[model samples]
Target: MNPELAVLYAKLDIYGEALQTIKHESGAVCPNFMTCTCPPCRASYGSWALASEAIEKATKLSQSASQPEKPMSVCTKDEPD
Candidate 1:
């Protein structure tokens, strides 16, 4: 995976976790707590969640693709049974 992309994905993951924690601790008095129709809540949980999921999937695919395939091991005729 690209180093920059990896870093950005990691940052997003942290941000998502932080938001979750905040939401859990905050009450309904908080605009973005639980389920709010506020613009910030929509941007943070709606758009940001979608973007984070996309980035996470991309990161996983890139990591899996970059992995080296294992070479098949062959027994040599000279090897003892």
Candidate 2:
């Protein structure tokens, strides 16, 4: 969903649930990133218009982007053996 809407919803004090509904209904969560592909919410494209445009560009750049890549593993060097 448009992360911005999430913020608005946050300000309204209904971020998790209400914002989610609005985001979906508003077509903010670009279908390309709807199912399981989209980057993390923190990395979201912000507004619906921006997200939609980003999705389109990503699609044109790589047809396979429809299926987002597996998340990169966190650096293991910080962990003790």
Candidate 3:
């Protein structure tokens, strides 16, 4: 539920899940929650900083990490079935 957890998930390349967690959980505790649409929430990001290492790790994590693939539609042709 912590923003830090989202950060960790982001580092793991699970951005979608990380974001869902952030918006639904951590964002709830924020003063300016705005459904996690805020450029910067009322809460200072520094408050979530556990240490300089966490900040450094988060910074080092690449935004280009591969995201989970979306599920494909399942439609079977009569012949295929």
Candidate 4:
């Protein structure tokens, strides 16, 4: 599957479907392909890394944009999520 398309699907929150598309288009299981040590696999890893970074940046941007601005306050050690 195209790295760009994968990034798009990730942004759209359709990861399982994106992975399926990648498996169909590339004819390789996602994990095996990602970790393969051959030259092509190494290149794919680089491409995938770039796409992942882009997706992360976009997600952060969307989240930050959607949030209301507020002042930060220090929390005590007892605080929890």
- Number of the predicted model whose TM-score against the real structure is largest: 4
- Stretches of candidate 4 off by over 4 Å are 1-31, 71-81
RMSD of 2: 16.1
The sequence of per-residue lDDT tens digits that candidate 2 reaches over residues 1-81 is 899998876765543344455445554344454443456532443544454555556458667756688898888676677
Model 3 clashes, total count: 0
lDDT of each: 0.66, 0.54, 0.52, 0.67
Q: What TM-score fits each model?
A: 0.39, 0.24, 0.24, 0.48
lDDT of 3 by residue, 6-78 (tens): 8887776664445445544553346645445455653533333333335455556644355566799987867
List, residue by residue over 1-81, the lDDT tens digit for candidate 4. 999998987767776446445434543334676778877777766656656666667679999999999988878688678
- Kindly report which residue pairs in candidate 3 clash with one another: none
**Lowest summed-lDDT stretch of 10 residues in model 1?**
25-34
Name the candidate that leads on lDDT.
4
TM-score of 2: 0.24
lDDT, residue 17, candidate 4: 43
Roughly what TM-score does model 4 have, to 2 decimal places?
Answer: 0.48
lDDT of 1 by residue, 2-81 (tens): 99999999997897676555444433444553378776665556654555566577679889999999899998779678
Which parts of model 3 have CA positions greater than 4 angstroms off? 1-13, 30-41, 44-81
Worst 10 residues of 4 by lDDT: 20-29
